[model samples]
Target: MTLYEVTGREMYLKQAADLANLCATWVVSFPYLLPPETPLARLGANLTGAVWASTQNKHGAPGFCTQSGDALFKLFRTTGRAEYAELLRDVIHAHAEGIQPNGKITERLTYCDADSRGSRGDGGKTGWNETNGALMALEIPGIYIRTDRSGMFVFDHVEASIVRQDRRKMVLKITNPTRFDATVTILAEDARKAARPLGENAHLHWKEKVMVKAGQSIFHTIQK
Candidate 1:
């Protein structure tokens, strides 16, 4: 399960996008505007404003998270807004058709609606463990990845092999794509159920303040 499955905050990213737009816009005229979260706002109001505009047409007018959900995640985390979290989950799910084992989130990236009745194909299924899919790589103890963190793996294409050695010891092996090589940090607390209810052991990967190495494989061991 991805981050959306755990909290469903992304479900409301659209709404958050709308709100963030208003918030960011309203603050633009300020003598000294508060800096927004990274990759976007951290870039400045102009960049954040561009993100808002992109959110409006993300995946061409709603139903996408790569742009909006990311924006909302930053907003919600910064402002502690519930609406941002809700829209965050929705926007993420909008693009992500469904979550698969190994953190492969099959995304339409250009869907018409939630049920994915009429959707456009933009090759969202390329299987990239960037942002939304990296949720599966940290399924082991002491493993976690923060998608928005600079210099970290994307979390969409990373696949992890969770091996239980003896009783309390576990080994997590991660495979990444060659496109980007950032050190992704995967953390875990305990095994829990998934948000969307998947057949293959859908477990949530814990996250921490770390990053993933690009195209490189790494392992971490946890002892109970």
Candidate 2:
């Protein structure tokens, strides 16, 4: 499973065009591989329904989990499939609905309405570990998004936008998506000059790191 996550995330990090094509094929073939016998077939139908529904085309549950969402995000990043991202976001929000004030999430999730209440064994605990793993490589809007044409590579979870992306410079509108202050290490390249981090104290150089406060968005720019 770890390898699957890594490969999915790497598809974005490396921005390999071939890998993007491969990921698209994988998603297309996923439905056919399910067996018609047993409960697995029903679960497969639910998942496909949820994916299709998320796109407003009309649509799964207990199959909803942080790990599953993470995989979907990777697929979205790899293939630029809006549906994949939508489904994953839907799952994340639904899973969040079941979270307790103490931060533990219930084990099962219903794909219909983001409900997080159920007892599917494991004593109602299932999200902490997978959530951490998912967010560690969460994809956000930026120039580094995989494409047939190449520009840059990005790997990290930060709610931000790319204000500019030219050959000489790359400017990012960055925000810390987490509740607490964080030091985000954006695995990137083309950093030879100083970084302009508006209202933030961190510098973003080539392959360097930056820091941001909880709920604060900063304009971070670096020259090549």
Clashes in predicted model 1: 45
Query: In candidate 1, how many Å is residue 150 off?
Result: 29
List, residue by residue over 4-118, the lDDT tens digit for candidate 2.
3344454444444445344333221223223344333433332321222132321122223333334544444444556655444433333333344465544333332233212
Candidate 2 at residue 34, lDDT?
32
Candidate with the greatest TM-score versus the true structure: 2
**TM-score of each prediction:** 0.30, 0.43
List the RMSD of every prediction in angstroms. Answer: 17.0, 11.6
> After superposition, which runs of candidate 1 have C-alpha atoms over 4 Å from their true positions?
1-155, 191-211
